[model samples]
Target: MPASSLSPYTLNNGTPTPTAAHSQPGTEVELQPYTGGDSEREVPAQATDRSERPRHIFSKHRKWMTVYMVSIGGAFSALSSNIYFPAIDTISKDLGVSATDVGFTITVYMIIQGIAPSLYGSISDSRGRRIAFVTALVVYLAANVSLAFTSDLAMLVVLRGLQAAGSAATISISTGVIADIAEPDERAGFMGTNAGIRMIGQAIGPVIGGLLNSAWGFRSIFWFLSVFSALVLLGLLIFLPETQRTIAGNGDVPLRGLYKPWSYYFKLPKEWRNAPVPPAPKLEKLSWRTIVEPLTYVLRMDILVLLSWGALVYTIWSMVTSSTTTVLLKTFPDLTQWQVGLCFLPNGIGCVFGSVCTGRLMDRAFKRAETRYREEHGLANVNVKSQHDFPIEHARLSLMPYFSVIFIVSMALYGPSYDFNDLRRHFAGNLVASLGLQFIIASTATAIFNINSTILVDCFPDNSAGATATNNLCRCLLGAAGVSVIQPMIAKLKIRNAFLVLTGIAVVFSPLVWVQWRMAEKWRRNRLGA
Candidate 1:
């Protein structure tokens, strides 16, 4: 690209933002705000021409409705990823490929899930939300349709990667949409809902896939997914308005589009024709190409800490999920495929409960912290500076250790060290432990993610999409690594010992959670110029 094109758009004073890791190899990836969206809460005073501004439509629709829409988008990513799990053996047999080859599809899918969000996030930041959402869904729908028709294992593997690429963006972009409309205080509840619905999607995929495979075959699962995606895309078109603040200006922007209804053209009054056009997305330089730029956030200490913690959480969460067959089947061998699928119900329900409830709690917690801090400091309750200077890190992380410690304990309870099959031989004893473990782990982990993600978004309010993409990258890559190691760890250590090791890792790092909490506020205040 030409140097002119590679440069960040110069603001009024010709302020230069940091160049990316790509093209300019020696240039470090610093956390610099883009020229236009320097603040999430404030549009720059320089650009406040009323005629050029787009309206914000957030108040026109209900907040919960937006959360529900984005949550389903979040859910689809995991749904696409995990939906293939129970059907791996069936697919292997049907395609005349070895089970190992079929399994490679998952590895590829994880790798794509880890990497693809960068492309989507960067583009959505520079382009527009609706286009990115639509593009991802369209590709995802097409990939599912192709997968449903393909009999070749090779084609299936490739399509699986493409399917993952399309779906992963739903998560990163959903975060962007939330950041666009939600104030820092209410963000917790909204982020919690996203995390919760995402967990629901993740937990249910195996069950849905298993039942579909048992009744209709592996192809039917993909067929259903394609149709489901089509419906979601339609909903996005009809109901989910664009929430990218730079382009749309909050929730009330009345931007003209290429796809307007007949009424738009019918408003051919001479007055309407002379009206000013709403400003489109202010595209800055596109230096952050794909996975490279997002990975650079690892250089920032606060981002590095949260992303590391999130990855470990995902590692533990995926570990429990991967063991579903081993743990559940041993305890319930007589259970049908659908019954085994249904076993995940508690886990899914717990995650949903954790996500939404925690979201609300996050807001309340922040408010309480704000109130308490003001009282202790002898400052007025409405001090904007103190509120701006509030330690969001402490607010988000203060209670995290409790949830995390319990999370580890829950993992241990569900592990296969004892022959729960023989010991908890009665279905009643087995059922309670099985369900209880999932609820504890899923709920606790969901709370941790809700707070963690919301704070991360707070840290980089301007770069919401990029921060989320980096979060996805770190967590998924760690999750992929964790998934690859579980069997070997189990083989060498035994199930109990294996889980003990993983739990021990969590135990050891538990204090680091508080350490991150302590350090996060200083780093955030400094970088954000709070």
Candidate 2:
């Protein structure tokens, strides 16, 4: 018998046989021809079921799990930074320092917090996310523990810097995780969730710190933070999985190699190839080349100048509000720390509500445009793959006019009206201002993340994480610079003038938002291609 005529199974006489069922569908059943005299045995086709194919076990849970872990961790980390606000006066008295000096401690903490994110983000890209997260948590825990025992301002500043370093890892890495798991359409929702949680932590931190400080003095705040840090560290160690995509040559590429051609390294000997490829190492060769390459995108006439100015203005506005809260409470001598805490509760609520509303609106607007585009072209509904194609301006348009009104109301009326006689007005202004801040922040942040991340990905698609890390670095570094100067500006210019300055800056930048909104599609087309 020909080999093609034989079945999958062998007979008793060693002759192969074909099974009737295993034959091609719709074909007549055929018998196997036997080379030997003995009869042939038939073989059946292997059983297969559509449902038995291998599928991702954790795929469904991965995104939410990661977002939840990172958000919670990030919230706690941010809480540690600001929870000391209620204790600021107490701490200053204990350390024999002025309020301004004590304020510097917060400034230093903010500066460090801002600086560390980009560095850690780059590390997370080069190393694995799990390692970066775990390492950061451990460092954070240790810093909190150390902070619990610190008595002097110098020690406090150093330990706070270390704490900032650890916290920075969570913020940047969580962002990268969001980019990794979410489709662009879903990213704003994820970012909103992350931002919301962080705001909740910020809301709770001062209040909790106040209660703790009242009951057990300022030192006890660090002890509570230490416990929180320890819990976060354990949770992360157990639950946070690695998410960085592992591509060959990705880890091995050096700072110098970025500028060098691949052909230079590819020509090496087999012995060099066989040598055990070393594990991923930190790229510490911080040259102008490395620094400038990542920042080149930001330096573009169309990009960084506007973003930097807007971020600076926003930071100043936020800093003014934060600084004034403590001072404002001092005016109400009858109000305890607990009352101050209660006052801030409304701000948190407003933030959460505002962020959710803005996120939904942006998402809805993008979907509407997508639907319109499809309808106008007379095409059937299809999956929209990249968010890059959506109009980035709609996100900004939803935000600017609302925030501009709020900003004007806040600066012009809120400050001058706060009197010890009428606490209700103060509370109302705080609530309104908080809502406005949320609108401004959520809109700008979502817009920045949507437009900038897409731009970064398009600019350096092969190294999206690295590109994002650099963008994060600029934001943080400038934020740190802003942190350092914000208090001084407020103190020198006074709250009203400070706010007026902020308002002026915002007003100037407001036009840019419009410009960006109007030209965004053109920029996208020119930069990313139609």
User: Which residue segments of model 2 deviate by more than 4 Å?
Assistant: 1-62, 247-293, 377-390, 393-401, 419-476, 481-494
Instruction: Give the per-residue Cα lDDT of candidate 1 at 78.
Output: 75
Question: How many clashes (backbone N, Cα, C below 3 Å) per candidate?
Answer: 9, 1
What are the clashing pairs of model 1?
A: 55-252, 55-253, 56-251, 56-252, 56-253, 57-251, 57-252, 58-251, 189-359
Model 1, runs deviating above 4 Å: 1-57, 96-101, 258-275, 279-281, 289-292, 330-332, 373-388, 416-418, 423-429, 526-530
Q: Tell me the TM-score of each prediction against the true structure.
A: 0.83, 0.72
lDDT of 2 by residue, 212-281 (tens): 8888888888888788878876777655544554422322222122222233354532323455644554
Writing each residue's lDDT as its tens digit, candidate 1 over 320-406 gives 766665555555667666766676767777788888888887788888887887687765523221234666677777668888888
* Candidate 2, position 386, lDDT: 29
